[model samples]
Target: MKPVADATPKVTKSEREWRDELTPAEYHVLREAGTEPAWTGEYVDTKTVGVYQCRACGAELFRSETKFDSHCGWPSFFSPLAEDRVILREDRSLGMVRTEVLCATCHSHLGHVFEGEGYPTPTDQRYCINSISLTLVSESDQG
Candidate 1:
Protein backbone atom coordinates (compact mmCIF):
# COMPACT_ATOMS: atom_id res chain seq x y z
CA MET A 1 0.00 0.00 0.00
CA LYS A 2 1.22 3.49 -0.83
CA PRO A 3 1.62 6.09 1.86
CA VAL A 4 -1.32 8.37 2.35
CA ALA A 5 -0.24 11.78 1.22
CA ASP A 6 -1.99 15.05 1.79
CA ALA A 7 -2.72 15.02 -1.88
CA THR A 8 -4.64 18.10 -2.80
CA PRO A 9 -7.89 16.96 -4.33
CA LYS A 10 -7.70 16.92 -8.09
CA VAL A 11 -10.42 19.38 -8.89
CA THR A 12 -9.74 19.78 -12.55
CA LYS A 13 -12.36 21.20 -14.85
CA SER A 14 -12.91 17.76 -16.31
CA GLU A 15 -13.72 16.30 -12.90
CA ARG A 16 -16.11 19.15 -12.16
CA GLU A 17 -17.61 18.63 -15.56
CA TRP A 18 -18.23 15.00 -14.76
CA ARG A 19 -19.79 15.93 -11.46
CA ASP A 20 -22.10 18.39 -13.13
CA GLU A 21 -23.33 15.61 -15.34
CA LEU A 22 -24.47 13.55 -12.34
CA THR A 23 -27.87 13.85 -10.73
CA PRO A 24 -28.48 15.97 -7.65
CA ALA A 25 -28.46 12.89 -5.43
CA GLU A 26 -25.04 11.86 -6.67
CA TYR A 27 -23.64 15.32 -6.18
CA HIS A 28 -25.05 15.68 -2.69
CA VAL A 29 -23.69 12.45 -1.26
CA LEU A 30 -20.50 12.20 -3.29
CA ARG A 31 -19.48 15.85 -3.24
CA GLU A 32 -21.42 17.42 -0.38
CA ALA A 33 -20.90 14.88 2.45
CA GLY A 34 -24.59 14.08 2.46
CA THR A 35 -26.25 10.70 3.13
CA GLU A 36 -29.07 9.03 1.33
CA PRO A 37 -31.97 7.69 3.34
CA ALA A 38 -31.85 4.05 4.46
CA TRP A 39 -32.66 1.52 1.75
CA THR A 40 -33.28 4.27 -0.77
CA GLY A 41 -30.03 3.95 -2.69
CA GLU A 42 -29.92 1.92 -5.89
CA TYR A 43 -27.18 -0.37 -4.58
CA VAL A 44 -28.75 -1.13 -1.23
CA ASP A 45 -30.35 -4.33 -2.44
CA THR A 46 -28.60 -4.77 -5.73
CA LYS A 47 -27.15 -8.27 -6.13
CA THR A 48 -25.75 -7.89 -9.58
CA VAL A 49 -22.10 -8.55 -10.29
CA GLY A 50 -20.09 -5.39 -10.92
CA VAL A 51 -17.53 -2.97 -9.68
CA TYR A 52 -18.37 0.29 -7.98
CA GLN A 53 -16.32 3.26 -9.08
CA CYS A 54 -16.06 6.82 -7.98
CA ARG A 55 -18.67 8.88 -9.72
CA ALA A 56 -16.42 11.89 -10.07
CA CYS A 57 -13.19 10.35 -11.33
CA GLY A 58 -14.17 6.82 -12.37
CA ALA A 59 -11.62 5.25 -10.07
CA GLU A 60 -12.46 1.68 -9.08
CA LEU A 61 -13.36 1.58 -5.43
CA PHE A 62 -15.30 -1.54 -4.47
CA ARG A 63 -15.92 -4.92 -5.95
CA SER A 64 -19.45 -6.33 -6.03
CA GLU A 65 -18.16 -9.63 -4.64
CA THR A 66 -17.01 -7.94 -1.46
CA LYS A 67 -20.20 -6.00 -0.83
CA PHE A 68 -22.65 -7.47 1.67
CA ASP A 69 -25.81 -6.50 3.47
CA SER A 70 -24.58 -4.56 6.45
CA HIS A 71 -28.10 -3.60 7.55
CA CYS A 72 -26.53 -0.33 8.55
CA GLY A 73 -28.75 1.37 6.00
CA TRP A 74 -25.88 1.90 3.60
CA PRO A 75 -23.64 0.05 1.21
CA SER A 76 -20.85 -1.72 3.07
CA PHE A 77 -17.62 -3.14 1.78
CA PHE A 78 -15.04 -5.17 3.64
CA SER A 79 -12.26 -3.43 1.77
CA PRO A 80 -11.63 -0.96 -0.97
CA LEU A 81 -10.31 -2.10 -4.33
CA ALA A 82 -6.97 -0.60 -3.37
CA GLU A 83 -5.69 0.49 0.03
CA ASP A 84 -4.55 3.86 -1.24
CA ARG A 85 -7.68 4.59 -3.21
CA VAL A 86 -9.34 5.80 -0.01
CA ILE A 87 -8.08 7.96 2.79
CA LEU A 88 -9.20 7.72 6.38
CA ARG A 89 -9.69 10.84 8.46
CA GLU A 90 -10.55 11.28 12.10
CA ASP A 91 -14.02 12.77 12.38
CA ARG A 92 -14.63 14.59 15.66
CA SER A 93 -18.07 15.90 14.91
CA LEU A 94 -21.48 14.94 16.40
CA GLY A 95 -19.94 14.75 19.85
CA MET A 96 -18.06 11.61 18.89
CA VAL A 97 -14.87 10.47 17.27
CA ARG A 98 -15.28 8.28 14.19
CA THR A 99 -13.15 7.47 11.21
CA GLU A 100 -14.32 9.23 8.09
CA VAL A 101 -13.29 7.80 4.76
CA LEU A 102 -12.88 9.65 1.49
CA CYS A 103 -11.80 8.86 -2.01
CA ALA A 104 -8.14 9.61 -2.58
CA THR A 105 -8.44 10.19 -6.30
CA CYS A 106 -10.89 13.11 -6.06
CA HIS A 107 -11.24 13.50 -2.30
CA SER A 108 -14.95 12.80 -2.45
CA HIS A 109 -16.51 12.00 0.90
CA LEU A 110 -17.61 8.40 0.59
CA GLY A 111 -18.60 7.67 4.16
CA HIS A 112 -17.25 6.28 7.43
CA VAL A 113 -14.92 3.35 8.06
CA PHE A 114 -15.43 1.33 11.20
CA GLU A 115 -13.91 -1.73 12.72
CA GLY A 116 -16.18 -4.74 12.31
CA GLU A 117 -14.64 -5.89 15.55
CA GLY A 118 -15.97 -8.99 17.33
CA TYR A 119 -18.03 -9.97 14.31
CA PRO A 120 -15.79 -11.39 11.60
CA THR A 121 -12.73 -10.76 9.48
CA PRO A 122 -9.53 -10.34 11.43
CA THR A 123 -8.71 -6.95 9.93
CA ASP A 124 -12.30 -6.10 10.88
CA GLN A 125 -12.53 -2.91 8.89
CA ARG A 126 -15.97 -2.06 7.64
CA TYR A 127 -16.17 0.69 5.08
CA CYS A 128 -19.69 2.02 5.29
CA ILE A 129 -20.03 3.71 1.92
CA ASN A 130 -22.72 5.93 0.57
CA SER A 131 -24.25 4.51 -2.57
CA ILE A 132 -24.46 7.88 -4.26
CA SER A 133 -20.71 8.22 -4.02
CA LEU A 134 -20.36 5.40 -6.52
CA THR A 135 -21.32 4.56 -10.06
CA LEU A 136 -21.96 0.88 -10.70
CA VAL A 137 -20.46 -0.88 -13.71
CA SER A 138 -22.06 -4.24 -14.35
CA GLU A 139 -19.86 -7.18 -15.27
CA SER A 140 -21.52 -7.34 -18.67
CA ASP A 141 -20.76 -3.71 -19.31
CA GLN A 142 -17.10 -4.10 -18.47
CA GLY A 143 -16.43 -6.58 -21.24
Candidate 2:
Protein backbone atom coordinates (compact mmCIF):
# COMPACT_ATOMS: atom_id res chain seq x y z
CA MET A 1 0.00 0.00 0.00
CA LYS A 2 1.12 3.54 -0.68
CA PRO A 3 1.93 5.77 2.27
CA VAL A 4 -0.65 8.40 3.05
CA ALA A 5 0.25 11.93 2.05
CA ASP A 6 0.62 14.52 4.81
CA ALA A 7 -2.37 16.83 4.87
CA THR A 8 -0.96 19.48 7.17
CA PRO A 9 -0.28 22.80 5.47
CA LYS A 10 3.38 23.60 4.93
CA VAL A 11 5.16 26.50 6.59
CA THR A 12 7.92 28.30 4.76
CA LYS A 13 10.57 30.51 6.30
CA SER A 14 14.02 31.69 5.38
CA GLU A 15 17.04 30.41 7.32
CA ARG A 16 17.60 33.80 8.85
CA GLU A 17 13.95 34.05 9.81
CA TRP A 18 14.10 30.72 11.59
CA ARG A 19 17.31 31.65 13.33
CA ASP A 20 15.75 34.80 14.64
CA GLU A 21 12.65 33.06 15.88
CA LEU A 22 14.25 30.20 17.80
CA THR A 23 17.00 30.07 20.36
CA PRO A 24 20.37 28.56 19.57
CA ALA A 25 19.55 25.17 21.01
CA GLU A 26 16.04 25.26 19.62
CA TYR A 27 17.33 26.23 16.24
CA HIS A 28 19.73 23.32 16.25
CA VAL A 29 17.11 20.75 17.16
CA LEU A 30 13.97 22.13 15.52
CA ARG A 31 15.55 23.52 12.41
CA GLU A 32 18.71 21.51 11.98
CA ALA A 33 17.23 18.20 13.22
CA GLY A 34 19.82 17.75 15.97
CA THR A 35 19.38 15.84 19.19
CA GLU A 36 20.12 17.11 22.65
CA PRO A 37 22.23 15.01 24.99
CA ALA A 38 20.27 12.23 26.65
CA TRP A 39 18.94 13.01 30.17
CA THR A 40 19.79 16.66 29.77
CA GLY A 41 16.50 17.83 28.26
CA GLU A 42 14.30 20.11 30.37
CA TYR A 43 11.26 17.82 30.30
CA VAL A 44 13.04 14.50 30.53
CA ASP A 45 11.64 13.88 34.01
CA THR A 46 8.89 16.46 34.15
CA LYS A 47 5.74 15.12 35.80
CA THR A 48 3.41 18.09 35.79
CA VAL A 49 -0.05 18.22 34.27
CA GLY A 50 0.13 20.36 31.18
CA VAL A 51 -0.11 20.64 27.45
CA TYR A 52 3.08 20.50 25.45
CA GLN A 53 3.20 22.79 22.46
CA CYS A 54 5.64 23.12 19.66
CA ARG A 55 8.30 25.63 20.61
CA ALA A 56 8.63 26.90 17.09
CA CYS A 57 4.97 27.34 16.31
CA GLY A 58 3.13 27.06 19.61
CA ALA A 59 0.90 24.34 18.19
CA GLU A 60 -0.39 21.86 20.76
CA LEU A 61 1.34 18.54 20.27
CA PHE A 62 1.23 16.31 23.33
CA ARG A 63 -0.34 16.22 26.73
CA SER A 64 1.08 15.24 30.09
CA GLU A 65 -1.38 12.35 30.28
CA THR A 66 0.37 10.61 27.43
CA LYS A 67 3.84 11.07 28.85
CA PHE A 68 5.74 8.13 30.34
CA ASP A 69 9.12 7.51 31.83
CA SER A 70 10.73 5.45 29.11
CA HIS A 71 14.17 5.87 30.73
CA CYS A 72 15.52 6.73 27.31
CA GLY A 73 16.75 10.10 28.57
CA TRP A 74 14.24 12.20 26.67
CA PRO A 75 10.66 13.30 27.24
CA SER A 76 8.61 10.37 25.98
CA PHE A 77 4.95 10.43 25.00
CA PHE A 78 2.76 7.53 24.04
CA SER A 79 0.83 9.64 21.58
CA PRO A 80 0.21 13.14 20.33
CA LEU A 81 -2.81 15.25 21.23
CA ALA A 82 -4.08 14.78 17.68
CA GLU A 83 -2.90 13.00 14.56
CA ASP A 84 -2.88 16.26 12.60
CA ARG A 85 -0.90 18.15 15.21
CA VAL A 86 2.29 16.36 14.29
CA ILE A 87 3.76 14.79 11.17
CA LEU A 88 5.96 11.74 10.81
CA ARG A 89 8.44 10.99 8.06
CA GLU A 90 11.11 8.38 7.39
CA ASP A 91 14.51 9.45 8.60
CA ARG A 92 17.62 7.61 7.39
CA SER A 93 20.32 9.36 9.30
CA LEU A 94 23.22 8.29 11.50
CA GLY A 95 23.14 4.89 9.85
CA MET A 96 19.66 4.07 11.09
CA VAL A 97 16.14 4.06 9.72
CA ARG A 98 13.73 5.81 12.06
CA THR A 99 10.49 7.75 11.93
CA GLU A 100 11.00 11.43 12.58
CA VAL A 101 8.30 13.54 14.18
CA LEU A 102 7.89 17.20 13.35
CA CYS A 103 5.54 20.03 14.14
CA ALA A 104 2.69 19.80 11.63
CA THR A 105 2.32 23.55 11.34
CA CYS A 106 5.92 24.66 11.34
CA HIS A 107 7.67 21.55 10.10
CA SER A 108 10.18 21.85 12.89
CA HIS A 109 11.79 18.59 13.90
CA LEU A 110 10.60 17.44 17.33
CA GLY A 111 12.26 14.03 17.57
CA HIS A 112 11.55 10.40 16.75
CA VAL A 113 9.03 7.66 17.42
CA PHE A 114 9.66 3.97 17.94
CA GLU A 115 7.32 1.03 18.03
CA GLY A 116 6.98 -2.44 19.63
CA GLU A 117 8.81 -1.56 22.84
CA GLY A 118 6.07 -3.07 24.96
CA TYR A 119 5.15 0.10 26.79
CA PRO A 120 1.91 0.13 28.82
CA THR A 121 0.16 2.73 26.72
CA PRO A 122 -2.92 2.84 24.51
CA THR A 123 -0.49 2.44 21.65
CA ASP A 124 2.79 0.57 21.75
CA GLN A 125 4.57 3.58 20.34
CA ARG A 126 7.09 5.82 22.02
CA TYR A 127 7.55 9.38 20.92
CA CYS A 128 11.02 10.41 21.99
CA ILE A 129 10.91 14.19 21.87
CA ASN A 130 13.38 16.98 22.49
CA SER A 131 12.44 19.21 25.38
CA ILE A 132 13.83 22.23 23.60
CA SER A 133 11.31 21.66 20.88
CA LEU A 134 8.38 22.05 23.24
CA THR A 135 6.82 24.52 25.66
CA LEU A 136 4.71 23.28 28.54
CA VAL A 137 1.59 25.14 29.63
CA SER A 138 0.80 23.88 33.08
CA GLU A 139 -2.79 23.09 33.94
CA SER A 140 -2.91 25.87 36.52
CA ASP A 141 -1.85 28.31 33.85
CA GLN A 142 -4.37 27.13 31.32
CA GLY A 143 -7.16 29.20 32.85
Top of the candidates by TM-score: 2
Top lDDT hit: 2
Residue 25 in model 2: lDDT: 90
Q: lDDT of candidate 1 vs native?
A: 0.79
* C-alpha RMSD between model 2 and the true structure: 1.9
Q: What do the candidate models score in CA lDDT, each in turn?
A: 0.79, 0.90
- Residue pairs clashing, model 2: none
The sequence of per-residue lDDT tens digits that candidate 2 reaches over residues 19-135 is 998889999999999999999999999999999999988899999999999999999999999988888888889799888998889889999999899998989999999999999
Task: Tell me each candidate's RMSD, in Å, in order.
Answer: 2.8, 1.9
Clashes of each: 0, 0
Which window of ten consecutive residues has the lowest lDDT sum in model 2? 1-10
Q: Please write out the lDDT profile of model 1 over residues 1-143, one tens digit for every residue.
A: 22244577765455467567778887787777778888877788788899999887788889998887778888888888888788887777769978877888888889888884544654567788888888899999999
